[model samples]
Structures are given as C-alpha cells and as structure tokens.
Target: MDTNHNKSEKSFKIPGDWKEQSKQLKEKFSTLTDHDLKFEAGKEKEMLERIGNRLRKNREEVLNIIKEINLS
Candidate 1:
C-alpha cells in the first residue's frame, strides 16, 4: 500500500480577474514614454520584454495595494 504524496502535485492558479487586470495594465504601460526609447537603438524586442517584466511587477504592486486597502 503506497500512500506517499508528491509535493509537485500541488499547483497554484492566478485568479482570472487578476489576470485580466494585469493584461490591461501591461497594454496601458506598453505605450508609455519609458517604452518608447527601446526602439531608438533597434532594441524593440528587448524593450518589449523589459516592459513586460515591469508590467508584471506593477501588477503585483497593484495587487498588494488592493490587499493593503482591504479591497481584494
């Protein structure tokens, strides 16, 4: 009788609402001035990836803010 459990079996999922919110935020910031310079040196791809990372961080920060304000 094998009753062992695998830790890897546990998986976490981001809420759909949060995912949509993050997508919207990423799109919004993608057009901001900070992302515009990325195209000046022929680094559009790099700029996009950097903006993506920043957007992810922003999403996390927003989530934290909502939590702090007891809105989530």
Candidate 2:
C-alpha cells in the first residue's frame, strides 16, 4: 500500500473558519474569483489547486497562506 501518496493527498487541512480565511485571502489576492475560493465537501485538493493556479503558487504555498491568514 502506498501510504505516502494517500498522506500527501489528504495532507492539507483547514486551519480555522474557512469562510473567514477565504475572505481574507480574497482581500489579499484580488485576482481570486469566487470560483477559485469556492470550497466543496471532499474537494479540498481541488480548491487548493484552483487557488494555487490563480496565485502562481504551489500547494504548500497555498496551505501556508491559509495558515498565516487564520493565525492573523
């Protein structure tokens, strides 16, 4: 069993209130549209990919941004 692949897939986690964090992200990143930030259940990876593409960032960068925003 390839546990590493599964772990990476499920690695990212929502740190705090996603709504509030997403709002902050939108404020910081004007290019992100509603569609980019729109999160669906069990679709976290997709949402991150959208945000990463819009921001020209990688998955880790997106995760870090979300974490930093939630901390602030």
Find the candidate with the highest TM-score and give its number.
2
- Per-residue CA lDDT of candidate 1, range 1-72, in tens? 657543443232333454444445445555434342233344434544454465554434644433443332
lDDT of 2 at 45: 90
Ten-residue region with minimum lDDT total, candidate 2: 2-11
Error of 2 at 48 (Å): 0.3
lDDT of 2 by residue, 1-72 (tens): 666664645546677688888889999999999999998887899999999999999888988888789788
lDDT of 2 at 69: 93
- Candidate 2 is scored at a TM of 0.83
Angstrom error of the Cα, residue 11, model 2: value is 3.1
CA lDDT for candidate 1: 0.42
lDDT of 2 at 6: 49
Pairs clashing within candidate 1: none
Please, what is the TM-score per model? Answer: 0.27, 0.83
TM-score between model 1 and native = 0.27
